[model samples]
Target: MGKLSNCLSMIQILMARPKVKIDDLAAELGVKPRMIRVYRDELEKAGIYIESVRGVNGGYSLDRRSILPIRNFNSTEVQELQIAIKSYLSKQPDHDSTLDNALEKIKAAQRDQALSSKHFYFANDYLINAEVGNESEHYKRLYHAFNHRKKVMITYEAASTNAVTKRTIHPYAFVVYDENIYCVAYCEQKEALRTFKIIRIHDVVLVDQSFYLPENFDIRKQFPHLGFIREPQEVELIIDTPFSNQVKESIYSTDQIIEELPDNAIRFKATLNGEQSIKKWILGMGTKARVIAPEHLKKEIQLEVEQMLQNFQK
Candidate 1:
């Protein structure tokens, strides 16, 4: 961490708790106790003050009300910020050094405050076989086009058809769905809001042409399922033993209900998002889990299994 980063971290530590020992601060920041005093002096010079406690177990404390101008984030908030940084960096081919530096500072402070971190992650296994090229450059171009209200010409390979074609698009905003980054843009060819997976875009050219975004255009409202608005479907499942326990550990939906069954099985019911995601989860569990309701979903899973059997037989 740099000087500014260290100073910010020191402030974070002070604000989080009543006091921290000088030696503890030094150990957390990987510096000497004497340097801790130097940092204190530097911070006091900038109108933030730390009070010294005189005695054994003596340390430093900050009056949060006095430093109200500086925004102090709790441990949970810091963790959430880290998750956002991870999501953004995951899309780029190379790490964003600026965000990485910021993450380091936050981590230092997190350690200093003895804050327990809760991991928040998004799935990305769908991208394992993806064609990765100069993704960083493509991302930058698309971002620039979005920011400047300019159009972009992209050679995109359709995931469904595996057909590559060029199209002019008015970039709107970046959308992350099912652990993939997509550009929510107005496709001139489609004449509607469409999502193009970032990794699927093989070529990008920023066009000088300018376009205006509709003032009333809200991406979430336009594409309900992509964002906060999800049309969840009711699902019932019988999951055996450890898989049931594993499912119990996670909250698929706020209204989810679970019932203990004989032989350590569970009857689980939840209004989860989309049949596709639910179908995938059931298929992943194999014979350990079986769908109990939404008869159509049950038939679909049966069809999938039958196809798998056919493949194996062949």
Candidate 2:
């Protein structure tokens, strides 16, 4: 039998007997231990649970629940599966409907309950510009670095002055905000966690050097104040009447403290980083937003508006 056929047969055998030794299986199938590992990965992708056990008598097992028999698929179930797969594929830049059709046929043939249960759904409201140029390549490299726990060298563009410089970093995760992709990595140069915009990356090179992630490290918990902008700063504002509610929901801030006023107005406070991002956001709100604290920010906004008016008048 071919490798694919052999792998399928191995899954069937493992399903019949939940607990089976890797060595015993390899001997029985006349395949090497390396091939067994490969087949195990393929089985996992197919939604089968193959877990390794440790100790003297420990081996591999098709997790009890995952060994359940395939469920019959009705027309509705098949259509739902097809729709779910197509929806997921649509999110990718290069995927097409044909792949979705093929997956649907495969699901129909297998009638796998796990596949049926593993449906895809997503919701997106903002418009994202398709990334271009070396940026895409940089993103791919960073993604691989994160997946493989490897270090990388990246030429990055700073948002403040658009200055480009090279730095070595340990990629932790990729974050998407304001329709832009960012690499949240541990910067070796800075000795701190920093977020790099993919669009700003001029080039990337993966290095063989690898590092282990700290056990207590949780990206989401560490960057609670992060939004579209990755910088760290705090700002409080008291928005005048008629604009407070809109500002409360639309503005991206860490902690939004809203206080109702006597004259139908509201006060909002939020911690923000990335002054440029906040400035742009304030400009987007036009007159609806008012800067309560930090006199410099208000002045900056005034100057920007004046410049904008000058352009329009000309």
- Over the stretch 128-227, how does candidate 1's per-residue lDDT look in tens digits? 1122222356766886776578999999999889999999999876544454456778899989878788888899998999999776665545555445
Off by over 4 Å in 2: 1-135, 151-153, 156-169, 174-200, 207-211, 220-234, 238-243, 246-255, 261-265
Q: Each prediction's Cα RMSD? A: 10.6, 12.6
TM-score of each: 0.51, 0.46
Residues 182-209 of candidate 2: C-alpha lDDT, one tens digit per residue: 6777899999888788888888998999
Model 2 poorest 10 in a row by lDDT = 118-127
Give candidate 1 regions above 4 Å deviation: 1-17, 20-151, 157-171, 178-181, 186-193, 206-222, 225-232
Extract clashing residue pairs from model 2.
233-272, 233-273
The local distance difference test score of model 2 is 0.64
**Candidate 1: lDDT of 84?**
60
Cα lDDT listed for each candidate: 0.70, 0.64
